[model samples]
Target chain A: MSLISQEVPAFDTRVPAYLQRLERAMDALLPPAGTDPDRLHQAMRYACDGGKHLRALMVYATGETLGVAPECLDPAACAVELIHAYSLVHDDLPGMDNDDLRRGRPTVHKAFDIATAILVGDALQTLAFEALANAGAIDAEQKVRMIRSLAHASGSLGMVGGQAVDMASENLTLNIGQLESLHARKTGALILVTCQLAGIAARAPEQVRHALDRYGRCIGLAFQIQDDVLDQIADTATLGKTAGKDQVQNKSTFPSLLGLEQAQHRANALFDEARDAARSISGDAEPLLWLADHIQQRDH
Target chain B: MSLISQEVPAFDTRVPAYLQRLERAMDALLPPAGTDPDRLHQAMRYACDGGKHLRALMVYATGETLGVAPECLDPAACAVELIHAYSLVHDDLPGMDNDDLRRGRPTVHKAFDIATAILVGDALQTLAFEALANAGAIDAEQKVRMIRSLAHASGSLGMVGGQAVDMASENLTLNIGQLESLHARKTGALILVTCQLAGIAARAPEQVRHALDRYGRCIGLAFQIQDDVLDQIADTATLGKTAGKDQVQNKSTFPSLLGLEQAQHRANALFDEARDAARSISGDAEPLLWLADHIQQRDH
Candidate 1:
């Protein structure tokens, strides 16, 4: 579930087509009289394309596991994808991570300018809600609820909060506990929202939704923990950005705070927790069980 | 109203207190533990305080004239004020407006840093939805609907689209129609959302809501037209920021396109349209009429 995991099924066959459709959807939303869409669209496409789209797959898989219709999950899946896309755009802004490259190419701001990157991020954020609001297959209240769930997950209390904490910790010392708390609000919140949204879209029972939420929380941490592990073990060829740059920034991580062996054990434990939570809920999620193993065991 | 109009009112006694409460609501929603409450609080207050607070007045006065109780309107008024505050924070970000000063103080990003400013803006945006969602005495569906309205009015098709246009229009020549289209979307959209949110809170009839929306669209343009007009007539002492920066940037503006005299006349016509729409919809709109006059005849 972290960057470019080798075992995550190769980008879905339909994903390219879906990406195409997403572009068409985005283009249609822009007014004809506005500044040329050529550049904005190009930048949006560059940033939005090439993800493994685990979020979308989770959504579609959730519906399938629950015996719900694929159509029932299409909008939910697309809405989540939009959120993921928006998060990446904002994450790569000049002020945040300041990454010049992502997924083996220039980041949006690097390829375009800072102002265009900002608009790209803003447009994507708005488009996420726009997709949910106009998702014709769902109940209006359900769509509204979906928008609320996504907003909370991506907003200050969630990912942005995490970013804030990360910013606070930079050039400072922190223990493992504090670092974990930072990641929980930042990364865990949205992953939990992901699972909860899927469950809600499937109309799963409250108990089941809670269990899936726990599962996502565990996996989110496990994913980041493994990311720390890979930051030490992996090289730039496999990991997109320069490896060990996190260390250069004096950022605290599981590996730095708790040693690599201990971080590995913690990740394994989190995977176990995810498996247990998913298994205990309704629906046999053998694929999720496989995913938990895959996450802890991935090479890159 | 333009900065040079002759009918400016002294500061309303309670508007300051209302702004304070809005500031507190925004501050309370930041990260609970990692965030420095004092810094975040100071920034929120600095970012939101000292505005004209015309949006809240519109909400409060609109509800009042419609015969709705103050209690029913407070949350809606708070919500509009929150949106205005959020927009200012984002608009002043390095990639958007790159503004370092707002309301005679350092902008949020300048007061803190760009990342905090972005997060603060994101947080405020979510809090607007949270405010509407948790607003007491409002029906659940309508609460959700009002949240959607704010998003719609501010999102891609509205404010975001306007911003994209604004950013894209740097150094480009434009006619009056194009200038109006941009401002109508950027500033006017949110103004319309403010009035609609009030109508929704008051649970006004659909016909009245629609009529108020029309009124808002008209007055929203007038609001910006006057802003453009004032940029020409007012000096820095009265206008705060560089008085004629719009012309300096070659940014398309009403006065730039229509000339100062025509821009002033267009503003009056737009205000007239707003007044007629409000009155035709209901004779009980005495407060809205007064507010409209206040908008049309303001000084500084």
Candidate 2:
């Protein structure tokens, strides 16, 4: 993450605090009881926290820039994180990516049983929509929009679609174009939805929503490419998670295709293009500008 | 079922026709296309269709009894089916019930892979909200209510929560009370939502909505009890699917907790209670009467 080198951007005053608030909001809205509440809640804490949280930050930042009251996006912010957490949980399942580690501790399936992992993932996915619908003070329609966007991003034609491609890729070699197509769904969909959800949370115009979504698509993969590059360059402690697991698995990846140097160059170029894309399409916004910078500069 | 003596009483001419329309609408609203059309669509189809039409009928009946045009409830009817379909897809996952057979055919995982089955379930869950949001020509508030009920039923406190209990019961002996709690979330949450949704579709008074929801919870458990009994009584050929697998697996179901005779008696008393529950809440309506009679006697 090129952006990881930029001193963490002086810690956005509102974002980290808002992220905490949103996390609590989400936890409160979930089932009060379940299969080993202590374990599930503990795993949820690790999975949700301890990240740079570029996605949640983007949603909050854009909503701030658009003049929407910070409180107005509580539902939206919680909804996005719920989706993000759910994706991670499912991605590590036995029949899926089958990874054993995440963040630091064992992956969800490893920490809990696979059955608990699946249900926990399912509950989180559903809790996201519940968070949207039960966001305390938001009107029902806004909650509906928030939940729908979160669902669309996490469902088919989005993150899950991308995972399907990534899973299938184990069985076939892919050209650069196919690789990008696969990443578009897996990595790009949520990132783009991040932009759209932020804009929608602000009640921004449809044009604004569409433009930020476009920005999300271009930069999301660049983020992934940088991730690929960093995996080769960075260690586990540096990245805050396991690195080079993708190569070990022989999965098609950005570094595998473009070479380390080429992938890095592509990420830098895409970041610049993303900045231009936002400016050209939706005029300009400082949050998006910083977003491009954040994606390109992160170290982890 | 102990209540199997009842018949599908002849109803007014418009009733069946109204139900047919709702079935078409519900089917049309579901199976929304994903980027990968083949796998996602087939999984969607397998997950969604061939239900008993009980949910859709409830909406139409509630509307008819309340003097609302039958079409007024179509959107809500469609939404309930979507929620039901999504739950079935998730419940059939490898980590959950692990059933390879559903509705007399191979489960979605058997037809596709486990990952596709998961995606299909996730997508259908999201599509339920999407359908509520886009249901043709419905009021904003109506849309909101439909979204609320769908989310509640699909979330942790409902179907998914019920599933956790069922899964945990594999190594434990559950008494009748525990069985009821398990089915309450697994089956009753959505059934209650179904009646609530129908009452909402008719724009019934708050009291009417409350009453029908009461009816829903009653029938929901009765339906599940009869389900457990039918697995013992109905042949695989007649059930169009595997039966008696529950006992063979040592699963703690109602019939297992109490013997077959006691379970049958309990189911019959519940059926009468459900009918009384409906009557206690509503004026004479042929459709609700027919619904109670039909559910109590169904063979499949």
Interface RMSD of each: 2.9, 2.5
Q: For model 2, how does the per-residue alpha-carbon lDDT over A1-300 read when each residue is reduced to its tens digit? A: 566445433324555686686667656765444443345545455556555667777777677657666677777777777778788887888777787877766887887778777767777776676666666666666666666667677766677777777876784778999888888878788887777776766777777776776678788888888877888889987876688878777877777888888888888888887887678544336667777886777888
Worst 10 residues of 2 chain B by lDDT: B29-38
Q: Model 1's A-chain: what TM-score? A: 0.86
TM-score, one value per model: 0.86, 0.89
Write model 1 residue lDDT over B1-300, tens digit each, in one string.
365556534334445665565455545543343344234445555666676878878877676657666566666666677667877887878777777667767788987988777767666666566566556666666676676687778765677667777888989998878887888888999888878877877778889988998889988999998888887888866865557777776798887777788888889988888889889777666667777888888765
The best candidate by TM-score is 2
| Candidate 1 collision pairs | none
DockQ of each: 0.36, 0.44
Candidate 2 is scored at a TM of: 0.89
Model 2 chain A poorest ten-residue lDDT run: A31-40
Model 2's CAPRI class is acceptable
User: Local distance difference test, per candidate?
Assistant: 0.72, 0.73
Stretches of model 1 off by over 4 angstroms after superposition? A1-42, A297-300, B1-42, B67-75, B202-207
